[model samples]
Target: MKPEDFQFMSTMLKQRSGLVLNEDKAYLLESRLMPVSRAHNIKGVEELIAEIRKTNNEALIVEVTEAMTTNESFFFRDIKPFDMFKDHVLPHVLEKCAAKKSLRIWCAAASNGQEPYSLAMILKEEAAKLAGWKIEIIGTDISRQVLKKAEQGLYSQFEVQRGLPITLLVKYFDKQDDQWQIKPEIRSMVQYKYYNLLDSLTALGHFDVVFCRNVLIYFDQPTKGKVLEEISKLMPDYGMLFLGGAETVLGVSDKFAPVAGQRGVYALTGK
Candidate 1:
């Protein structure tokens, strides 16, 4: 691939999805976009770049962005966060919202629905406490493809094996041929939507809890701060944010601070 092509792609990706691709990932562009090119009957990455430049095709642009963004997910990934949600966040949010009798949770960059669904299962297990309350789990992702999979609520056997326990899997999922599908009740608890984290989040309204795990590491410092700041605005004083185990808000933004004794969990500053 030409240097110009690499630069164009990297810049476009950063602008469109906040994904920073350095020269070391030039090979990744070739490997990932080659299939997209072939599927569209384009010749190669060079030609793909030329076509995108010439036409500015919105569909093609979306395809390219979706191809580049990672959609890796599994149920209850990195267990500790969910443990915190159950043991800490949920009880606090429940008490805080007790008078309102409603709760809203957002799973940003929610790929294939696992994270939100995991929360749904947890909520289901606590049905007695939430008997008369309204609950909403909103799962959003930039990739429409993954959102479709999430809406379908289907998972392969291998997918179910990862990070999912036997008892919960048996209780919540029904075997459909070889793949397991989450029961409709649990599936109905979450709603999926197409969203880009870089875009304004006002229309989505407020959320009491957000899970934006493993997404900020791909962005540069400024983008990270911008996203964190925007997310902070969407939460109340007591709201909680869950990030990837490797990600943090220390240098990125002052809108949030690490929750005391909780790794990968953050609370709004001054709360």
Candidate 2:
């Protein structure tokens, strides 16, 4: 790809999704977008770039963004965070919200919904204790294509095998030919929407827990701060924040404090 085209797409992506693309990332773009080029019947990256410049059609923009957005995820991708949630956070929240008998959990940047569905499976196994609680699991992502797949709650065979235990799979999903479909009960437990982290969180409402993991590493510092601030706005004083193992809240925002047991889990605190 030409330097100018690379620069243009990088700028466009950063402005739209808060994801930063450096000059060294040209190869990354080429490898990821090569399939998109082939799918569009374009011979090379140059032709794809030309097509992008020729049109700003909504469909084309979505196609390109879908091609660009990272969708790498797996059920219970990291065991420790969920362990912390069940061991520390849930216990605290269940005790505090016992009178209300309700809980709200949000998985932001919920690419294809593995994180939320994993949580649903966990809750299903521990149903006895949560019998009376009103559970709301909301999953949101900036990519429309991903959000649609999340709502369907179907995973390809390869997807099911990755990071998912056989017991949980047998318990929560039904086989449908080549795909594994999350059962209706688990599917109905979560709601999904298209949400850009750059947008306001005023309509999202406060949540007891928010999983904004792994998404921020792609963003620049300013964008990271903006996302963290927006997240803090919709989180209660005691709400929890779960980030990627490689990510952190320290020096980025003061709205949260790291929880003791979990390395990446953070709890809302006075900022």
Candidate 3:
């Protein structure tokens, strides 16, 4: 890719999905977008970039963005965050929202649905306590392609193997030939939607707990702070935010502070 073309692609990705592509990652453009180029019969990535430059092709642009966006996810990607959610976060949120008997969770950059589905499985385990509660789990991602896969609730054998316990695997998933599909009960517990972190999140409404794990590392500092600030607006003082183990709110925003003993859990600042 030419310097100007790389700059154009990187700028478009940054604007569209808050993804910061540096010069070192220039090679990634060809590796990831080549399939998109072939799918559209555009010959190669350089041609694809040229075509995008010359036309206002929304579909092509969307395909390119989705191609570059990482959709790497697996069941319970990390054990620690899910453990925090089950042991500490859920209990607090349940207690705080007990009067209304309602709880809402948002999984930003939800990828292929494993994160939200993992939360659903945990909630299912505590069904007796939440028997009459109105539970809502909204899983949102920038790529509609992955969102579609998530809504289908199907996963390959390799996908189910990652970070998923055998006991819970047998309990929640039904094997359909080689692929495992989450049972309807668990599948119905979560909803998937296409959302960009760069866009306004107000329409998503309030969430008692949010799992925005493994996402912000791709963003620059300003974008990270802006996204965190916006997320803070959707939660109450008692609401919690779960970021990736590598991500933190410390220098990025004043809206949240780390939970006393938790590594990846954070509570609203003034709380």
Scored by TM-score, the top model is 3
lDDT tens string, model 2, 1-271? 7888999889888888888888887787788778888987888777787788888666766677777889899999888888888888888888888899999999998899999999998888879999978999999998888889999999999999998999989988999999999999999999998888888887988898999989999998878888888888887787888999889878888888898867888887877
Each model's number of backbone clashes?
0, 0, 0
| TM-scores for candidates 1 onward, in order | 0.97, 0.95, 0.98
- The digit string of per-residue lDDT tens for model 3 on 114-166 reads 99999999999999889999999999999999999999999999999999999
Ordered by TM-score, highest first, the candidates read 3, 1, 2
Instruction: Give the winner by lDDT.
Output: 1
| lDDT digits (tens) for residues 1-271 of candidate 1 | 8888888889999999999998998888888889999999999978998999899999999999999998899999999999999999999999999999999999998899999999999999999999999999999999999999999999999999999999999999999999999999999999999999999998899999999999999999999999999999999899999999889998899999998998989999952
lDDT of 3: 0.92
| Model 1 regions lying over 4 Å from their true place | none
Estimate candidate 1's RMSD in Å: 1.1
All-Cα superposition RMSD per candidate: 1.1, 1.4, 1.1
